[model samples]
Target: MSQSFTTKRYRRYTEEALKDALSAVGNGMGLREAAPVFRLPRSTVLRHVEDTTQ
Candidate 1:
């Protein structure tokens, strides 16, 4: 017997919201501080910052 594997991709925020979220970080904020304010995961916020810079 063979088993099939699947993965579910995470839902992403809108581009405009993501941009605003990261801008807060650029203005000397932190993921911990920003996440709660935006009601998002810290990792998600950090990833947005990293993605925009690249």
Candidate 2:
């Protein structure tokens, strides 16, 4: 027997794009504040901010 797995495809952002999101912070916004502006999850933004490899 074989097992199958499936996952819903979600939007993906590039490094530059993520960088742009962080730009908001540099411009005087909070990390969580920038997340909404970029339409990205706060956790994801923070994770990427803390870990560049994301």
Give all candidates' CA lDDT scores.
0.79, 0.76
Q: Judged by lDDT against the true structure, how good is candidate 2?
A: 0.76
lDDT of 1 by residue, 1-54 (tens): 987988987766676666677888899988898877766778889876888789
Residue-wise lDDT of candidate 2 within 1-54, one digit each (tens)?
987988988777676667888777667789878887777778878887677545
Determine the C-alpha RMSD for candidate 1 after optimal superposition of all C-alphas. Answer: 3.5
Instruction: Give all TM-scores, in the order shown.
Output: 0.60, 0.56
Which model scores highest in TM-score?
A: 1
Off by over 4 Å in 2: 1-11, 14-16, 52-54
Q: Candidate 1 at residue 46, lDDT?
A: 81
Cα RMSD, each candidate: 3.5, 4.6
